[model samples]
Target: MPYPDKFNDSYSETKADAEKLVMRANGREGLLTCCIRPSSIFGPGDKLMVPSLVAAARAGKSKYIIGDGNNYYDFTYVENVAYGHVCAEKTLSSEDGAKIAAGKTYFITNMEPIKFWEFMSLILEGLGYERPSVKIPVSVMMPVAHVVEWTYQKFAKYGMKVPQLTPSRIRLLSCNRTFSCSRAKEQLGYEPLVSLKDGVKRTVESYSHLQAQNHRSISKASIFLGNGNLAKTVLWEDAKQTVTVLLLLAVIYYHLFTCGYTFITAMAKLLSLTALFLFIHGMLPSNLYSPLLSLFICCIYLLSND
Candidate 1:
């Protein structure tokens, strides 16, 4: 299919314009330029595709498939994409290879096209998250996407974040975007350095931090703390509150305990500080400092015992 004369978003429009400029500059003033179009590039350290998919999964929005879920895509692994670029550069620099590759565009991939939804399922499942099960047709979702886009445009200045659901994105999810790399194989000697399966595995392993297990009620801290209320709030459980408590405790220790004051004087000062901290904490929102309050209570109990 030929390139569309217009694009739905400025991102796609600018990218198309840039590619055209690069193609136009190919043979001018000894410049050897070519476009390496990697299809649906993915893998570890990908800031766009994987993150958005994971975000949707976390947000409970990944339950529905965008279309019939039969859309095939050539999802290129990051390493394979790098290899493709290397091949292109080597071919462009070589005398024989440059004859065929210098001015042409090449579609690079892992050569293992998979059903788009299946690939999405693999990543989600690998990360201990549920795969999309409900299928919604593109026709049904397009209008919803349009509404969402319009709402985002209207409320964007009021701190409404840009939405993921858009007409172009919906089309991208539902379309068959597989590409043949035969031209690249014959001209540039390009081949994927990593298999698609391994790529997906590596990508999943890289995001262990975002695994569903970590987001569950039975987190590591909870398990270690015997699932007590303090277990969920103390130490490393809530990092922000833990750090704040530690800083406060450190100040109390250095300013009061280390001053060579009598035990009664130090205890009196500590109680006064704790009372003031609790008073201020009570004035704030409940969720904002509830963990701090719990930590402070625990500290007071421990000090009483000491």
Candidate 2:
């Protein structure tokens, strides 16, 4: 096959070049190229598309759902996509290969097509995050996306480009783009080995490593924010006071609630209260404080009922 230079940038040119290669390789004995177009390929360690969305959600950047979020898309697991390519290559090179080569173009994806919002919710749940609450229409985003794309293009001429909410990207988000994988399944016996849930689990495991890196970044940010000894001293003192209050509350709750001996219950309550107080104090000026406070309240309620 003749490799076309810079084919990734131009789909039409790439398809034409690929067709020529397929025609030439027809009835040939050795190697043949098969083009497998996969839909939204994603898995563990993915840094683009879905993984980017996941990261944005975690960082609170993705606050809104585009359109009604009812659009369906065929999402293919990266490993399954790879396997399809392998199968295509193997089938094309086999002795009775004309069966595989005759007008063959495979739409490789997971057999199941899922609604966009449902998939997003699954991803959020897998990562222990809440689903997005806001929704915006495609019509509303069009003008904004146009302006952003125009600004980006204008800046590109000056060799200075900025991130923009692009029109093409918005269109993709709004559209229902589900691909048929039945041809691939029939011809190559291809079946997705990884379910969406399993794939998300793998992705979450990879995200745990990234979270450790993020923790170090947050620690550095705290140091930077508390620039002086006075700031540090004030913060620590506030934290200590909060801890003392929480400890007292915990002791009262445990004695009245838990069946454990008074001493053990008091100690357990004291330690939990101390940790919760420090965490709450540290998270002030951040959005996490309210949720953490609510969680603590719930815990107290449950303990009292016990």
Query: Number of the top candidate by TM-score?
Result: 1
lDDT (Cα, 0-100) at 205 in candidate 2: 73
RMSD of 2: 18.2
Residue-level lDDT tens digits of model 2 in 1-306: 244564423444766777677767655674455567788877875777556665665445566788988899888888888888777877766757546655467788877789877777766666666677698999999899888877767656544445537776777777898978787887776889888778767876767654423432324443455533333443553444444455556656666566466777666766776665655554464356556666766886787677
Name the candidate that leads on lDDT: 1
Candidate 2, overall lDDT?
Answer: 0.67
lDDT of 1: 0.82
Total backbone collisions, model 1: 0
Number of backbone-clashing residue pairs for each candidate, in the order shown: 0, 0
Candidate 2, residue 132: Cα displacement in angstroms equals: 1.5
